[model samples]
Target: MVLIDRIRYLLEKLLEVFTIFLLLALTSIVLAAVAFRTFGSSIAWYDEVASIGLAWLTFYGANLAALKRAHMGFPGIVSSAPPALRMALFVLSEAIVIGFFAVIAYYGYHVFEILAWDRLVSLPSISLTVTQSAIPISAALFIVCECLTLPEAWKKMRAGVDSEHEAIEEAIRLAEEDLKENRS
Candidate 1:
């Protein structure tokens, strides 16, 4: 693949690894927090740490979802539309989603800056800045992934299918058409 493709691949891989690590970390933290609370011992920072990890995990997972087209939507609407209208709607929806996420990424950057300067009172253990950094980082990554996915979606919308999804869709379409023709 080309440089940009390679970069995207690497980012995706890194995000995948980060998501798994964060999930495991969050799970462990939750279990430990439960144990501590049960024993009448409190770890003041556990909640904050878990929240931060969960936020990061969620953002990365959202990006992964977008990349895989795993984000939930009402498929029946799109599937029922005529092809041209469906394509237009698909492109429009993707554009709207990208624009919304772009705004989010912008605000996330501002939040990160503010966090960097401000300290959390309860957990002076880690700077609020560090915790806030994950927002912008994940938002930026999400934006990148959405942008990368748009063209592929558009291509699929227009061309019916491309190298990526063509084989499977084509196979299914052929089978369905054959069944219909045979029935007729």
Candidate 2:
């Protein structure tokens, strides 16, 4: 369990770094494209590369959200049920989510075969598979994050204190403290 927690911590930091890098790269690409166009020349790879970067961002961002257990969920509904039913509901939800990502990863892998001969229009040297690899990679990352955090999440859910509620309470407390400090 401690091992998993450590791994989760590392994964979180890695994702943060990668996502920040992607954002910076994408911003630079757009700015360069705009500067070139303003001078009466357009970049051929601007649209294609930017779109790919955005897609990768979405996929990886989803994985990060999963790791944080910050994804959309109805914690109130689950917590209100009896303990037995709540456990079942939690299991069912987890199964559905994990199953969805599994299917995505399975098909995403097959996409590489279909795209093997295809290359980007703007940059013929780069294969579409390279850019599209984020699909399966992010899905797998999400699964890893879910598994790593499962034990602690289970304990929290069992205690009738969902992370969402806890987060909200924490946020409110912090905001109130800030307000008090400002008045002083």
- Each model's backbone clash number: 1, 0
Model 2 over residues 57-120: C-alpha lDDT tens digits?
8889888899999999999888888899889999999999899999999999999999999999
Error of 2 at 108 (Å): 0.4
lDDT of each: 0.76, 0.92
Runs with alpha carbons beyond 4 Å of true place in candidate 1: 1-5, 159-184
Q: Which residue pairs does candidate 2 place in steric collision?
A: none
lDDT of candidate 1 over 1-184, digit per residue (tens): 3765677678778878988998999999999999999999988888778888898888889888777666766445664578888877887887788788778778987876656767766677668878777766766777788777666566666655433344568789999999999999
lDDT of 1: 0.76
* Shift of residue 160 alpha carbon in model 1, Å: 4.5
Query: Which has the greatest lDDT?
Result: 2
The regions of model 2 sitting more than 4 angstroms off are: none
Q: Which TM-score value belongs to model 1?
A: 0.75
